[model samples]
Target: MKTHLTILLTLSSILTFSQNIKIPSDTMVVTTHTTTVKGANINYTASTGTQPVWDKKGIPIASLFYTYYERNNVKNRAERPLIISFNGGPGSASVWMHIAYTGPKVLNIDKEGYPVQPYGVKNNPNSILDIADIVYVNPVNTGYSRMIPNKEGELPKRETFFGINADIKYLAAWINTFVTRKSRWESPKYIIGESYGGTRVMGLANELQNNQWMYLNGVILVSPADYKLYNTSQPVYSALNLPYFTAAAWYQNALPKVLQEKDLLDILPESEQYAINTLMPALAKGGFISAEEKETVANKMAFYSGLSKKVILQNNLDVPTSFFWKELLRDKSGYTIGRLDSRYLGIDKREAGSSPDFNAELTSWMHSFTPAINFYIRTHLNFKTDIKYNMFGDVHPWDNRNNNTRDDLRQAMAQNPYLKVLVQSGYFDGATTYFGAKYTMWQIDPSGKMRERFSFKGYRSGHMMYLRQDDLVAANDDLRAFIKNSLSNGKPAKYEKD
Candidate 1:
């Protein structure tokens, strides 16, 4: 009988442990911290936690991880602005901007954004937290966020969270819950997205208004990726790449002596003008163009792109970006440039290939970011978890259909006179070229009536421009100016004539 009792006791203990070990779907851990930003000592509260995404029946389907930073001792919360931040990839965590860009801490890297030993994070003196509160959100399947299995052990459908329209729909609903929970409805709100997040905030601008009845004061796009411009065989897509090539070539000192001698900013306008006026039309002609015209276009493309005329004409005047990356430094240094940042160089097995073996910048970024995020979350923020921090999560087969986000932003701006936009891009960002970002801004409002509400700023870095120390200071200052300038300040939300 004693033996039987011992067995039962052991079974009960095991069950209790299992139940206790289950991760909480809705929970938060609050910690207090202080930092100096722009020469001001600021006290802030950091709330790190997970919130649930419920189904139509109110059943928890997924939980999203997020970190919220609120400046302490505020006179009035409603008067302060709230910035909701997200990083793109449709599968990337919020780690990039969380510990690096606008957050109070940044990765321990060199001034020019190269990885260093003793990987960890340090205080960012340029953090914009003093001017406004910030929240970094990790979407479902990224960071510690995960989908919950039902009582019957069935997971939610992929269509709910892995697509363009679906992403906007559910995220808008989630934002409503977050805003309501924090009692921030009255505060001036801004949504900022980087890379794919650019596409995201554009859609959210309208969705938050129409679906959630929530409006925003500003929308910020940093190195945004517009799908409409990408994933297409359109001539504009190929033509817009010229300016980016010029920027990359200038950085590598691959341009001709005359053009290379000029500043990158000075030479970029010439490339832009030629791309719009000359290259675009020539490419649009396709096979019907005269032989002499093709040769002339190829000669000019080689001049701007740093590729030989033979290579340009060999491809019939349509050069793939991959070829440019591999061939840019082929004869000069026998190296391949990075796809995202072109500033980083890679060694290839054979220099004759059309593309490099790996993305040098991404690999280098992971070396620092992966370790830094893991260490920061556990050490500084005091949020401990056994779950792996997925820098890049498994969210493949992403549905890209029905993406009308660009027009969505236009509609939002048209309806809300108070809504404004600020676009920031890095000159060396080859993935989503600065020129492509400008083109997107131009196409947003065809009527051009609300053009003044938009602004564009460029940096002398790559996709993650804030990674560089100098650009970090400049970028955050730009953000501060944008936020301050966007404030309504008792002005009514209606159009007025000067």
Candidate 2:
């Protein structure tokens, strides 16, 4: 009887212990390395870790993975600035920005940005680490970050962190925890967001400031998805896409000889003017516009874009990217222009289709960046985990409810007078065209008194401009200058228009 009771008590204790083993709040692995940048030897510490994000009720909701790098031998961390970087996809991990562009190491790709054979990585001499300490954050459901699954292996509760505002909430929590943990509250903070992350940055500026009482020094928006300037329907959508259309056509040498010889900048303003003044009004009028006027508009659009006037008129003078990409180079070789980088071409079985079968540019780099990051994590950073790294996880049913971040950005600028903004765009990026970014920034700061605080730069590459070596150098130089000016409380230097 005594032996039986002892066995039952031991079994119960084991069950309780198994049930009480909670997920770890953080798992950190630190490594040190040295790299040469511009003939200067720099040593830095790379911290690969996961930080827990708890809910308002003190319940652990998600674990966010992050890579933090700080220059070694720095006497005062308080004087150093911290840049938190992320890529956008609503579901994307930070690997895109980490292994491909800004991080100390970049994928060894060709000059044209094609991944090299045997897939590897190399030191990025232009890495922004030379100036500021950077932390690449992978939000919940991205990279190794995930929601704690229940006993049934279902992630029902983690769905809340997948939305726009909820993402901001948890991300803010993680950043707060990191800053507090690292003891760098006095350091100037910056946010570097690419694509959808750009929208996140704007919301974060407001959320972090209002909720967490953390002030930011500057924001770097790369290929920003400014929904305020976005429209899905015809006319407005096409109008918004006009400059990009012109850019692609120019790149493919499909534009008329007169426009082809002209510099891209000269053509962009014309496209913007036509888009806002002519195309928008005509599209808004709908049936009210005369056929003659529509014919004239179509002819002008054809001249700027490579599409025929008949095709433009058939589409109601509104050529969405889907149709334009297929139609622009269709006559020459039956190939479709890439939506991300127009320089890339794709061969679709059905060339007559409205949209290309796939985005050639997006797929081209995935094979390289995906493997390179995985290799770097396990091999160089010495961070090992059984969980598969999710480069772009499926954060489905992502709620966009009340996600107007432009207002949040405006509010941040209004409240924080010293806060500056650097808006960058790749002229060849069909996603977030340069003119669209310019329009949004123009609308954001109309007074022009803050003009010194705002700088708009255009790159010669696609959405991920830094993938191009020259653009990476340019971007790095610009960022270094921006950081210097921001830390000194001086107005950011103006970027000469491209």
Counting clashing residue pairs in each candidate, in order, gives 0, 0
* Top TM-score prediction, candidate number: 1
TM-score of each candidate structure, all chains considered together: 0.95, 0.91
The local distance difference test score of model 2 is 0.80
Worst 10 residues of 2 by lDDT: 1-10
Number of the top lDDT candidate: 1
* Candidate 1 lDDT over residue span 423-451, tens digit each: 99999998898999999999999999999
Candidate 2 TM-score to native? 0.91
Candidate 2 Cα deviation (angstroms), residue 438: 1.6
For candidate 2, write residues 145-182 as lDDT tens digits: 87764445555464578777888877887899999988
The per-residue C-alpha lDDT of model 2 at residue 399 equals 78
Off by over 4 Å in 2: 1-25, 150-159, 231-234, 446-449, 488-498
| Local error of candidate 2 at residue 390 (angstroms) | 0.8
